[model samples]
Target chain A: MSDTLRPTDSQSPQPVQPLLARIKRRSFFMYAGATAGATALALAGCSKDETTPSSAATNVSFGTGDASVLNYAYALEQLEAAFYAKVAALTTSPLLAAEVPYFAKLATHEAIHRDFLRTAINRDFGGTIIPDLTPKFDSIDFTKRVKAATDTKLGILDAAKAFEDLGVAAYNGAAKLFKGSVYLGIAGQIVSVEARHAAYVRDLITPGSFATNEGTDVLGFDRQLTPTAVFAIAQTFVEQKLDASTIGQ
Target chain B: MNFFNIIDLLAEADPDVLDRFSSRRAVFNSLGTVAQRAALATSPLFLGALFQKAYAGTASLPTDILNYALTLELLEADFYRQFLAAGQIPAGAAFDAITVIKTHEDAHVAYLHDAVIKAGGTPVTGSSTAGIRFNPSLLPATYADQLKYAQVLEDTGVRAYKGRAAELIGTDLLTPVLQIHSIEARHAAHIRTMRGQQPWVSIGDDLAADANYKAAYTSGVASSTRTTVALGGTTYGIPAFNPAQPSPQESNLQQGAAGTKLALLITTGIGSTTYLPDDAAAAFDEPLQAAEVLDSSRAGGLLA
Candidate 1:
């Protein structure tokens, strides 16, 4: 693209607002700047999420190459989808009535991620998507919103925080592994939403506690965990014996 | 290697080189005997990139990107600095949160300042630099008004990072850049929540709804084609705006590439009447072109 075509934002052509009041920094939709994209909303689109994940690959290995990086994401999204689906399903739970809708919204997002990755992997990589393993919820008490210090079972919020934080870190860490820019771009699309989710959950657990976690440091950098480290913690919630050692190699 | 001799050599080469190295504490050992430059000299994104730039006098994609990032960090750090000095922050969580966000912005400025130099480029300065300013005269006087700017800055920070992130793919720098990227998102979420909105960018979120703030959500580009970035002799392109999917507008619902966007509330529902345009819009944040970032009222536009 030539300089004539590019928006000369840095040139300061517009009138100055008091203290740059006109400057709007929100960048949620950076690529889709057209009404054409808006019109497509009415059209029926991508596949709905599979309600039941397959149990085919018990010892799943997200194989090498760019495919491995994607599979790693697929695994995490699957786990989150399952976790939130259960949270949303609670006929009775510890969550406040007002807070319930948030979890419901979360369920849909996770399911979308799960299905999107599943389809993309299957389409682009041709059957490279790993089988979705069953989640292990023995340690989580579905009835509780948060666990007390003495309690053994984890609360709903506890798991949500863990999953969202892990998801952000996993994406952040996994970006370098992608050889191609397209998948890396797609991963960037998803990870910010995960960070938003993580922030929201953190605030829920402790008000005003957003962005103050140990995963982030004084330098304001969030955590970036390699696949092996991510999988070690992720293993606790799933029954599958998955190996992520080769991911991003 | 003798530490003093190395420092002497470095100081001889450039008197301010030590100041440019931000991690002096980390560079030195308990005995202060280690060859400090050796640790950084081996890191390509650091000294190696700089050496090339110092001699070649040419900027790579990463250097340009870092300078772009540094410009904003300086702008943001200054915004909060003025806001905090004003002393109007509410006494509870708001105060704490703003303080933390300000700290992060400052850290970002410091971190990027050093990174830019280490990458073999001149670090962009705050206020005095072109396209970046912290105009105290322009700052909103009231806390409520300042929060609006804060929200805009934080969210813009997230988008700016995302827009340029693809260039860093496959580099060691992607991780740290991503680390910063997620924090920006976290800040955006918090600022939104503090503003009485959802943590995520919902369709027609108040900022987007406002005519003045609309650019915050849209790509500010007339075309759907994204600008590519040159990195390490490779150029990377973003998938074009799939008319089959959502556009860069915050309200666009369908998400994904040309043939594969999933229509959430429009086509499939999660059995909830509460399924909203907001959630669908919030699910996927777009990775816009650096040029698409608008001037005067949007992310990249915030400069100057």
Candidate 2:
């Protein structure tokens, strides 16, 4: 069965069987090969994606490892989902008719992202998942675009832009921390979409300002923020406190 | 077998393969004693696949990945150069904004080429490389068509970078590639907006007006026909042009191999009174494989 993994049966003679006979002469290659075999067997026996009930916690600690990464993403998604839900639900905001539908779409996307991460965490890590977060939006006006950068209250467009940009930077920085290729692929898929959202919102705020030097580096690389830095900014809008000190450690 | 045998096979297959490995050896060494042990513990099948995928075909080196990216960057940089050379784009802020994008593409081409050389791999600069040159004849003549084609190019570049990102895992190459990936996406949105299209890729964002080249949105490895170009007597086949997913069209709602669909509206309090399929589809963008990106590029006449 182990022979099936061989790159070319015709080229090299099988060395795995002989290595087992002389376990005391364990080399790095032998050790690696043995571990790889065991991990494959272990993974084959388990299904991490099976949906299971998980007890949620109050003060969300992203915990440790990749699960912590997913939970951190989940917490941010929850905040964005809530923010957009509020914006979409508003009946008296001074939004244009076309703008209302646009916000509605944004709300759906953020909700979908939140739910996807929640399901992923629940299925993969089970009880390590964070609880639903309550959002605080008193700093956002949701009525009008902020006239200046110093304004404490952000307009709907300003808030959306901030959230979308934050998400892009967060994902960009976090991709390197992922140990699994699967999670990295998923992050790659999602980060571009977030960038698309950021571009759209940035353009809506200021014409043709998408991908400007301010949002990206002088060489056009997008901004990347570490988890600690991201959560620091993100916590301001969330009613629930988030602890991501253990993430990706 | 022994680790030497596996590496020997890779080196024998491609002379530059060992150099690429050496460049990344430091990263693997720093994975720490425990992680190294875990790497050994992984199944031989898994490790075999990793090596094979990293070295398969003529395009399977870290240098190949960089060259592939350089090819796309060259194509984009040339496209903008032509757009500006034609004296067609209107002046003022829009022009300046486009100049920003154009300069970035130029910078990307330069940086990627330098990185390729620094990594001890030959950069594919469309010079002396057969069928790698930008075919301006394939581009649309009118300004509107120009912007639309630009949108297609930018979006295709976005997916192309994403499709091969996993291949670059555990190296310094990964972050830089992702940085460029997001930048390409930003360009896609900016071009889409300039074309009077939605910032997001909606259901009908297909580039080809003809049905034969319809796989624009959700393309993969087997989506288009493969064609080879000769450089210095060596034949290099452009990666698959069509996205290989079951449905390569942008209208696809299922994401990833698990086929997870976006159904946020089904959740309570989030349902829209008016059902809009495009909005749901547009809310999320799909990923393409390297072959799929090549296929889509050929369908658009960007690839030889």
Candidate 3:
């Protein structure tokens, strides 16, 4: 693996280069900006008072090759890590004292995973890692143990399940794109953990419901969602239009 | 001669270089006669030709794979039933759990077999007259021995199913296969925890205790410790990592080749372990040629 910790300074701040080598860099950026602006305008029009930060307005682009997949994972991890971190920072009612440490540990794990992907892409792919995602959790009520009519409902357990389930399906869906066995093995390891997390969270929702047919299909595999399918669900949490056309680019 | 020397040598080598060497050595060591047969059967570059033939069509549908998969579940069901009937499982909560698990396996077999027939495939039938028994030579002599063996069997089953999930994806049978796979993982986890292992720790967890635990289960000896296995002068050990405190690569096992030479040691004697059972091989799970399952009397051991 490349040295992900010490990202090359030259590649840090430059705006993302379009994947097509023949396209003029300036024209590509202009097109991306226009597309993003249009998307943001449409989003703004839909929710006039929505307080989505301007920083979260960029178009989600996959750079090239495996880095794109990594970024996809990174983005999901960002949503998850952020939610868990918030949960860990703010305690809620009916919080089992023993479960607090577990959530904290999950937060740390997600942070590490997020950083690891960022560093790997920076070091190996020589690209600017996608910026830290700002989640739109304005709707979630972190203060309520149960979902209140007023709150967004994006808590630790809910976020964990969504992220874990999405992560498993994403990896499963994307595993075919990876030509390298090393990548596949790494994916295999990650998905199993994701599956474990899925099981744990499923059990949390309903005890012993972890490995049942209800969540997974008949073959005992986790439900796999196509990129388009997952992005539809994820777009709710993120402010940006994740352009996954270049996913396996 | 020592652990440090081995680590030093391994540390200097790049991952790809090590991977290549491991692959080549695995071919020469394990694929000896079979490799020769495969080579002779096809033109030059037989391996590529073989893969081309194997993955020829998208027609390797989920239903077809599941029909074949039902065979594996049936085999496990038979194995557990025989073990139960032979009074192999110890009398305790463990035994009660094993009985419950056996019933689940039976249910899985029935479900899969029914699905297979529904999908226009033959329902796999195990022999009532031709009983398939565990290798008495490899099994433990006591009740704890039985528990350890069952634990390892279930754990291996869990990994095996998971390892094949990708191939089954996008098939009609994907849901059923995934359902079974998760249950198998759950069963493996429950059995492992019953054997004084952590409930959350997967058998594939590359932790220090994992190796020790695997060794104990395979060998039926509590004194077994985590140790590296030597293959062609290279040693591989399960590295320890806490899931809650994952390292950079701890969350993912670093990728290797599509087919790398990784030895799965199954303890045969008190200390010596062998490879996984022949029936456990991926080739056996696929539809076999006439020569593959020639024994009419031993159909239970082969098909079901």
Candidate 4:
């Protein structure tokens, strides 16, 4: 009966192979393992530096939140305070009889801002952020008020203008990052004062220059700067590394 | 099988499904990638569109914009008034200086209002907006609060002029705005000094934390970088203007270097030499445009 069944070609069916099925399953497993391993590695890499501060603190890195923003402002304030204090301590000129009082007042103001920011950071974030600063004042002759007839004893005025104008733009650009209304309100008040300082300094250097490009932006608008851009400049004076990846995130 | 034939067979077997699939696929694919990319590629046009919406729509020149500007000045005026009233300003030589600064802000409000009126606008009357009103909630009811208020007002004033200076360019009322703008800067310096802050803290510091102050100061220093001395020459590394753009009167003045030289001269000390050169005597500094002035004034000028 077996021989008869094998001999009947029309009634016999073709044998199906199981080898291909085994190969397909093995391939699928291999791909799955690779994908799993890749995903695991990715997660591990992402979590490695989650909270630890970077080792190179002098590299001028920033954290990715409001703290970075404050650090930026603090850096600028430090630079300004330092410059004005230098000017106050060493008057380039006799400092016009009327200008002495003005400079002295400005000196006190800068000190307050510098200390206030330092205190705020310490109190609110518990983060110590006073960085060592080295200003590049080789371009400026602090000792001489004027080297030429066209040049005036307006170095302090010019320096003041640059700082005030920069301050105004920095604050305006940062206004959006503030989440709390109270902080926003405080920022608003501070920016106005900075603008006023910009105008005053510009006018001092050039009468009728205030509010103009000659004084401010001739186009009649305030300037704006992104955190990244502002930080780049601030990095110059700062010796310590600030990891600002957390700013405005 | 040929690719086309396979496609044809699939279409024939389920024409309805293929049609629906293709139509849906087209929509999804279009939505998924090309739309945003296309929009970004046309960014300049998009920016122009955005500018039009911001500056040309019915909502353009909104009252909020003006109110914001006026509110900044008002806040500053109030801070100085409060300081003067509370006797926070020390009596004696320093008091006179503070008083002069306080008066300057009052004058700023008056002149700012005048400019607003000239532009057919109304001055802000009260502080109702959350941003306009100080959050008395944050203060600890100490003199610190007062100092904080003073700092806020002074900073705001500095930014306000910076924010609005562009809008005021080429306008008839720009002169007054400029006057106020300078006076506000002086006030800011005075206040910063009062608050023990640096008068020029914001210059060249990009990472500055305060948004309002940064925005007003660092707008276009790199791109349209032009610096001219009063003595008719370029200051720093900035280039001088071409003669082609000079006005007719400027052309006549250009015939003689003396006029241009006089106009460009910068005086070092406060003396008779401080005067602009004879050729520049008739040359009034260009004023800001009304719209620009308004827009800047509103964009949190001193207050931002």
Candidate 5:
């Protein structure tokens, strides 16, 4: 649980020391640069009260230890469940008649996943579970699929595919971070289901593309992304600012 | 009270600290009356001796675990070899998918063979490796049948890796095993897609005809190895090897060491109102035991 993300005075070399100790020189610079950018963004967004550092407002710290890892997963599950719930709610949409019910099933699975992680965290690390997050889906244009990649909003299928793939990578990367065998076992149970979901969604986007290099690597391994990299992409779809500085600490 | 409280606190702080003590529960369950009383009076020396005795017969070496994986990889590779060599596979996307999967399985065999050798263990080979040879008799005749059989093998391979993962924890072997395990899952999903089925395990997955193929979903060894018991009047099937950790079945409502039932929606408290019973169980895939995996491969006629 290093307090590495705390806003520090540039004049004093105090806070940077622990950052230097914990991370490599290259990673240290990257984190410091991101924090500096966060500071600027926060300053621009806040009102006339220039005295307060908006670091707390802009960033959602994942905290530290195994509990932090669980909270990180819980946060992702919340986003996925929220996204599929929205898709399932669409009454008249471009999605095929046959495919609509499957979305409802996917929604249920993600909701069950969200609730499962919350209960696991509450039982294993009571009072440490992160609060239920508020979702932001303004960017998703659920009505139609846009051909251009640069469009601000994504079609439902496009969004579902991205979320499923990201979730699989998140679980794959986070699997080794769990210290307890019980938590590790639970992670293993959920990750394969996510992979299955990813494959199914990918095929819906393009038949026979399932498990290809688009989703899996050239070596035929599924992608594994660290929390820092995952949240960088994930935070855009989410309104709640997340800080993984202490995750798996 | 003080001693028990201390144990509880230590267990909470770092559960591995109490691993030796927890392991004692399994040993005690099987110990005779005289031996059980003797174990209770444990000095440090006696406990250490008891611990060694407990693990000596049961503990699987890292080498053994790696070789076990290597054996499965060989089985899969050989199956694909027969598949590609069959010469009747129709040309198209489905055929290409099988080819890609076959290439990956070959690479898996290569990687595991080298891994086992590097870990100071002899990699079991097809030559003179008496029990682990491939049997091509069960290779399906038609393209559709081949795809069905492929799905079964890939699903079994995924579950087999998951079954042994707990044994590899805290070792250098875990990362590679998991890497391959995820790939196997991806392979299983795509194969299922080619067969026009849902990627996730459907309730009562009726893809294969053999009753034993259900072992891919739930696996247990012969009944003689375990005594039958009932939980809330429902009789539970017992496993022959490692009775303490029975293989998980797809129909299992419970998950993790806490045994939380996802299907029950205990956390949500809405019960099956929001969540269907089948989808709740379908959401999580279960692990298979190594003994059960062996049984599956044998049944598929892939093991000589």
Candidate 6:
């Protein structure tokens, strides 16, 4: 995919190299220790981000000013696009048959967001765009719709909700950082659509819980987390550590 | 008439009345000395809601933008209140959910009101419902009509905030406006879900198919004459957009600049999904001019 599953960013072979290595390492581990028939379980169990010690060294700086903000959004969209792609590609998806269409829609929407940001950033800032991010969805179980509280890995819906809600807050807090009105306007356009996605996913999880606490704050205001706070949560799901310092400054 | 209904009445009276400085611009421009005297001594009587709404508390404070925002919030909040009272919504989940939305809207009204007053400007007061707008009798007297209207209002809320958000970018109010904007989208999505429609805006998501709700999908943008906006002691202007095309409607697949529209539509082969023009349209929600928010078929048509 242009947006995910591979690196098609401004940086060519560099971004692709690490991602390929990560998957290859997991493949070797599964074949050497586990049997051939247990491939799915082996990949899920042994492919956690912790196994990749090189991840911490792969920290990405999103650059300064509007470049940083655009990169911040691009990084998130990358993670989301990758996650939904895996979900949609699931051979043994635990998600309901009726709910499959929603994931498909989410997959395309996220890819569009990711690719659009890439196109915009590369067009506007040229060489300053960040390298393609490697999404670490090892902690998500595509075979489960919702996981137990004690489970380390999340189900499909849990991860979707988290990504959508995180996306909404991220845009709200970062949009004002943009100096240009057109960019800010575009950010507004995308964030509301993200909110819509979040609400629909929330309803799927709980009948009438759309736009609840996870989406809105106490005063009925929607959640607006700063980039620093957002990056903290995002760093857990991605192989790269993103530093949002000086964004929109 | 309830206290807030008067705001809707005026919104219905002038479809181009935005978050509106056009009619009030020449009037406000002449009030260079309003800071030195009473608004009543200088302004005419016809400028009622907007006059006080824009120049409510004091003349020295710059709060026309915030006042415009407050005007919309008050209108939506009152509409929800009246709709809840009409008993058209189903009980259990549907009623509970709409009530939750109404609560958030009311909270927005309170917060925006205080924000205006805190900026050293008088907050616009709500008026009686006697001469209120938002005609409730035009529908088929059904719950589906109620939900559809709510969907239109919520989507409009999202677009309205997006339209004026750039004006408040330099100020501290941008995030709050954005935060509220998303919440409105959430409300829109939930209502659309109840109606069994796609959660996000799509090309087929036509509110105008019924003909009566034509204004909901109608397009408008800030006029070239009103391009510059003043905020926080600095004047900010909109970036260059095609005057030939202006603001695109909900069904528009083109985003950002024309040069980048194709790039934004990149499908990239994710799970055999080739995104069409409609997906591009649904991915982004365009802004509606604050000057052209209400129209005969949109929110204005509901005005009594």
Best candidate (score: DockQ): 5
Clashing pairs in 5: A60-A243
For DockQ, candidate 1 versus 6, the one ahead is 6
lDDT of 6 at A187: 89
List iRMS (one decimal) for every candidate. Answer: 8.2, 5.7, 11.2, 20.6, 2.3, 6.5
RMSD of each: 21.3, 16.0, 14.8, 26.8, 8.9, 14.3
Worst 10 residues of 5 chain B by lDDT: B229-238
lDDT of 6: 0.71
Error of 4 at A204 (Å): 2.0
Query: Model 2: per-residue lDDT, tens digit, B17-75?
Result: 55344344653564459657466635587566556655554345677778778877877
The TM-score-based order of candidates, best leading, equals: 5, 6, 2, 1, 3, 4
> Compared with the true structure, what per-residue lDDT tens digits does model 6 show for residues B1-304?
3212443565454322333443444544654575532443433453464456653322222366666566667667767777788888888998999899889888887888788778877555453253332454654467888778888888888888887787675679888878888989999999999988899988777565667666677675333334343322333232333346445688776666622234243343222346687788788888876545644445544555
Q: Roughly what TM-score does model 6 have, to 2 decimal places?
A: 0.74
Q: What is the interface RMSD of candidate 6, in Å?
A: 6.5
Which portion of correct inter-chain contacts appears in model 3?
Answer: 0.12
Query: For model 3, how does the per-residue alpha-carbon lDDT over A1-249 read when each residue is reduced to its tens digit?
Result: 113322234322112222213344465456547663533332332333445423323456766566677777778878877877788888353446766765665665465455545655565556646666768776566665445455556645666677777776776677655433344444554455456556556556655455555533543345666677788887777765566777755
lDDT score of residue B34 within candidate 1: 45
Can you write out model 3's per-residue Cα lDDT over B197-284, one digit (the tens) per residue? 4334422333324542333112111222232222112222222212342222111222222233332221221122232222112101
Best by TM-score: 5
> What local lDDT score does residue B301 receive in model 5, on the 0 to 100 scale?
41
Compared with the true structure, all predictions reach lDDT values of: 0.70, 0.67, 0.50, 0.45, 0.69, 0.71
Model 4 chain A weakest 10-residue run by lDDT: A11-20
| True C-alpha contacts between chains kept, each model in order | 0.69, 0.56, 0.12, 0.10, 0.50, 0.79
Tell me the tens digit of each residue's lDDT in model 5 across A1-249. Answer: 234543354423233334344444466456657674533533333435334432224345577878898999999999999999988887786788778877887998898888877876777688787767768787789886432576777888888888988888888777777666667777777888888888788778887676777634646567888899899989877755666777877
lDDT of 5 at B49: 70
Indicate whether candidate 4 or candidate 6 has the larger DockQ.
Answer: 6
Query: fnat, candidate 6?
Result: 0.79
Model 5 lDDT tens row, B213-243:
5555665664334222221112322223676
Task: Report residue B97 deviation for candidate 6 (angstroms).
Answer: 0.5
